[model samples]
Target: MSNKTNYSYVGMAFIILVFGIIFVPRIVDRIKNQDITRNDRMSQGQDNNFKDNSKLIFLEINGEAKKVPDFSFTDQNGKTITNKDYLGKVYVVEFFFTTCPSICPKMNKNLVDIQDAFKGNTEFGVASFSINPAHDTTEVLKEYESQHGITNPNWHLLTGKKEDIYKLSNEGFNLYTAQDDEVEGGFEHSGNFALIDKNGFIRSRVLNGNPVIYYNGIISEAEKTDEDGQEEQISMLKEDIKKLLNE
Candidate 1:
């Protein structure tokens, strides 16, 4: 072979050696760690595409997964609903009163959006426990449901004994709730929403390996940021709900 041809061959071999030293380990590591996802399902030997649920986690307490507590309340339709009713279905929970004048309206509006986004899916549902059951009776909740355009059959505006509701909110879900004669609405409750999995376990997407625990229910999806500079989480909640449903 000509000396020029021999030089070209040496150049190609050196380039390959450099690539093996610099890139080959990284490529193998990426494949091993699944940093590189392939669209070829046949090679993976999977019947269906699997969702990346690595970021999703259970809300744990004392090293064990925290599950939803038991409770039974009457829905707007006058039918009884309980934690058991949510089994085999994913749901969202919130503490609200129909007459809330502060953040509850915005919260439910966002929830209504979530309901609409996942419309026609029986496996998805919403649980709204009224903080003021005395005023937010089944009849009142029925009206609020109509006002907010909540058409989901599984979305329940529940009301029951005052103590039970408060206990469920403060003690069970840890979403704050209390009666205040000083507040604008004469009541106070958390403006966050909790996402639950199909098996009645509280679930959320993690941030830096820590569970988010709850989603902001007060922000609107249309708003880039609220007055406090908080971005809306309704979009995140919808995406996470889809992940849990597929799980």
Candidate 2:
């Protein structure tokens, strides 16, 4: 047509382009936020299902269930214990040192109680891995085990090179237990009990301490034993172990 008509058409196209530029990201953002809200609701629902139904959500970290990393260590009795030894048994593994002035006692006590509870149940076992291997030799571990009245053959107190133990805790078990030379000897360890199923996959982590007290002074006492939320956590751990063993 004419120049005037062409300019009018170009102006209309420019207005439409500007409107799209201003609103597109906002629309996209609204859509993204809606998806996130949906996901959050689903997660909460799944958590509720666990609490109400007493079922768990197990994550298969290593393809077909996570396998406990293989490593060899000397037990309190100076006997070598390896991943092969626990092939057909369900086991709970924790990291601690004998003389830890912090959480070790409580964690060990809980472990002791677990060992005692499942005593003579050949299908299940417990292992306490020493974090301070330089000081916690096999002899020291043996003495510590005896002092605690831990006598189950299936239960093991293991000690190896300090580096090896640290690596196992950090990498193999996915529990970040490290030696803090600045933090007075013991170890800066997170109280966690990794439950490995019969097939050697880490199924769940039982928080192994009291929020108020890093250590429970006794393993059984640390368990969820009261009406408090603490008792529920402890009881759930027990139930989970039972379920895993039965599997």
Candidate 3:
């Protein structure tokens, strides 16, 4: 071959080799990273798709996993209550007064749905404790229960001593519960539903406030559903309840 031709051939080979060296590793690294990312996504999808079967793992209260103190109160039928009564059932506990003309109605409706959802499920129950013991007597709670058609055995509308309910709200659940004497009632409570495991330990605290309202109305008041509405809150609450039940 001529010298010029030979030089041309060698230069072409050198250029090809240099190009391969620069681009091949980058292409291979990109493929590897893409594979890793895909695998990570699949792993996460599988984790989300799988249903967890464990039941009622208690969350820490006051920095420790401890069973709440047991106490006695009266149900709407005037029966006494204690931790032993719910020893083998997962109970949902909420604090409210009958005269609450705001969030209580929505809260009660949600509880009713929950009760209906677990109608035959003996492992679950609902307890609505009166923060205004003086006003929320057994008779008053009975009337309230009747108003809502609460027929499920697992659901109880309870009224008790003011101090007892206050302690349960504040100390047992590690939540804020107080009386608003200025508001013409001895109680003004927050909207929270606590999931109490069979062992009397709290598993989750579901806030009953509807973020969409951000005011007096909760899920029930907004008849016309907005872009961001109560369904989201209800769905989250149901998922949390399921998780707690299957902990």
* Best lDDT among the predictions, by candidate number: 1
Tell me how candidate 1 scores on lDDT.
Answer: 0.78
The C-alpha local distance difference test score for the whole of candidate 2 amounts to 0.63
Compute each candidate's TM-score over C-alphas. 0.78, 0.68, 0.64
What lDDT score goes with residue 179 in model 3? 73
RMSD of each: 12.7, 14.6, 16.6
CA lDDT scores, all candidates in order: 0.78, 0.63, 0.61
lDDT of 3 by residue, 1-247 (tens): 8999999999999999997555544433332233322112211211111133333333433335557678788998889977788877777777778888766887788777767766787778887888888888899988998899687876888877888888877666544567766764555665656666766765532132101111111343224333443232344345556665665
Error of 2 at 228 (Å): 12
Comparing 2 and 3 by lDDT, which wins?
Answer: 2
Off by over 4 Å in 1: 1-55
Q: Please name the candidate that would achieve the greatest TM-score relative to the true structure.
A: 1
Note the residue pairs that clash in candidate 2: 66-201, 106-216, 109-219, 110-219, 224-231, 224-234, 225-231
lDDT of 1 at 168: 86
| Candidate 2 vs. true structure, TM-score | 0.68
Sort the candidates on lDDT, descending order: 1, 2, 3
